[model samples]
Target chain A: MQYKDYYKILGVERGAGQDDIKKAYRRLARKYHPDVSKEPDAEEHFKEVGEAYEVLKDPEKRAAYDQLGSQWQTGEQFRPPPDWNAGYEYSGGFSGDDAAAYSDFFESLFGFAGRAKTGSTGAGFHAQGQDTHARILIDLEDAYRGATRSISLRHPQLDATGHVALRERQLNVNIPKGVYAGQHIRLKGQGESGMGDGQAGDLYLEIGFNPHSIYRVDGKDVYIDLPVTPWEAALGEQVTVPTPVGKVNMKIPPGSTQGKQMRLKGKGIPAKVAGDFYVVLQIAVPPADTDTARKAYETLKQAAGFNPRQHLEKQS
Target chain B: MKNHDSAPTLNGEVLEDYCLSLQQLCHGATAEPEFILQLVEYEVLVPQGGQEAEWRFRAEDLARLRRAQRLTRDFELDLSALALVMQLLDELMELRGSG
Candidate 1:
């Protein structure tokens, strides 16, 4: 395991006082907290900061850690000497339900004893397990046609000896059709198992959509940019457009401008209320590279005599 | 990684608006009824009903409550401050989404 420098993680001096350490932790927590922060990798940084605070906040843990000396650098190969913590006694074990979020270095030093204490229970004790939450990404097409997904989850579990270890479980889940983003799917009795005769907790999966090349989704509504030739926008014509379900012929009214939006009702996501599919027209102008194309453009310029900068000219 | 194709498929119930009861919300959030009641008093959660026993919450409430719990714990915020923070966060999310 690599040594993690708690002082470096919290950006404090090794000789810093408790008050200084606490203030630094609060500042970093505010900046890196997953729920509040917009920074990339905020969750990872937040976990590191939280772990640092967990050790630094407690006087016992801090003193015991200090005994290791400051000669070690972060990410350097590290192993505790035999009976490194023999003289120190920790009053309590690690707090929080997410001990698995900590690093191997942390678990190697402090995880086993504290976690074992919490995992142990008297005989015939029955308490329901804690519920679990996770987010799953599905394809936009899967939302329309309902697909089966195999998901793997890693969680902390206790062995027969009451030692906590990370375990992975896989489940094949059937995602129902018409599910939209921000929705939850509850799988009963699929979460953490109870200690004795208690029931297992439920698992809640929040649904999110993978970004699609041709489509953008907001709630249940879908949007796509449809490129059209200038003539198609200027003159009325029937054009084939792609929708989530399939391609359908849509009429482009005469004098349709660039960025004009057309709505196909009940064609977005196949939800209970059914969102609408929107097609925004993007006018693609052909370049006058060839002589014939240049001539055609010249003739159109002469015929139409349209001044697009009239408003700017009037303002000037 | 082991093959999971032979595993039986589990169908989950989609949690829609106003589909969760107070009891279920508590279990989903890992919170106590009194804490939920405090949230209701703070207007952080607006369940549909007159009494706490009869309240029905939206599925989204579970997520909202969890957020509230985390912010309160991390920041040592009171209910009033937490309520304000929640509203500001909602507005911030709206602005970001639209932009």
Candidate 2:
């Protein structure tokens, strides 16, 4: 296992006060919390921050971790010396239910015994297992046509001796058609197993769309920027617009300006109440690179006498 | 490790609008009924029916409820303040999506 420097992860000095450590944790947590943050790898960073705070916030754990010494660098191959935590006593069991979220180094030091004790030991105790949540990214095309997806989930299970181990399980799931972003697919009895005769919890898979090059989804509505020639926008034209289902010929209205949105009703995701597909017109101007092209542009400029900066001049 | 090729394809139901009961929502969110009730009192989550027993929640409500739980726990926010934050976050998401 690699040694994780909890102090360095939290961006505080090894000798920093508990109050200062807490302040740093709050600042980082606010910045990296996955729900609120837009940063890439926010979830990973948040988990690292959480694990660091878990150790440093508690005085006992902090003292025990400090004994590991500051000589060891972060990510260095490390093995805990026998009897490292001989004297210290942990006040409580592992704090969170998901012990698999923590790193191997942290688990090796303080995790095993605490987690083993958390498993239900009483003969008569029977309760439903906790439901688990996971987000899955699917293609927009998959929403149009239903598809099967293979997902790998890390499930924590207790052995016969009550030792918690993270077991990776692969499940093939049928994703229903018309599933949109923020929607959830509930797989019954796929979550944590219940104790004794109690029923297993359901697994809720939240659907998110992988970013597509040509499409942007807002709810069920899909938007695409279609490049149209200046003449095509000026004098209507029939253009083949690509949709999730297939390519369809769309009539571009005459006098269409740049950024003009044309709505195709019932053409978006195939929800019960179908959403509208919006085609935003982007007027593409041909470059006047050649002499003939330049001449044609010059003639049109002289003939039209059009100034696009009229609005700015009027405002000024 | 389980075999990937021979795994049975499990069919799942897509949770649609106003399909989840209060108990289902609570289980999905891993939150207490009291916490959900507090959320309702703060107007953070408004279900479909008048009575709590008859209430039906949307799939979106489950998502919102989870986010609410995380924000409240991390920031140690009160119900009223969390309600305000939730409203602002909803507006922010709307603006981002449209923009």
- Going through the candidates in order, their DockQ values are 0.58, 0.60
In model 2, the clashing pairs are: none
lDDT by residue (A1-316, candidate 1, tens digit) is 8999999999999999999999999999899988899999999999999899889999989998998999999999999988888877776667756777889888878888788876768899999988898888999999999998988899988888787788988888889999998889999999889878999999999888888898988889999899999998998789998876789999999999988999999998988999999999999989999999999999999999999989999886
lDDT of each candidate versus the true structure:
0.89, 0.89
Question: How well is each residue in A1-316 modelled by candidate 2, as lDDT tens digits?
Answer: 8999999999999999999999999999989988788899998999899899989999999999999999999999999999999988887647755677788888788887677766756898888988888888889999999888888999867788776677988899888899899899999999888887889999999999999999999999999999999889989999999999899999998999999999999888988888889999999999999999999999989998999999899886
Tell me model 2's lDDT, rounded to 2 decimals. Answer: 0.89
Worst 10 contiguous positions by lDDT, candidate 2 chain A: A91-100
Question: Residue A212 deviation, candidate 2, in Å?
Answer: 0.3
Task: List, residue by residue over B1-99, the lDDT tens digit for candidate 1.
Answer: 233877888999999888888899888988888888999998999999887777889887888988998898888899899999999999998888656
Docking class of 1: medium
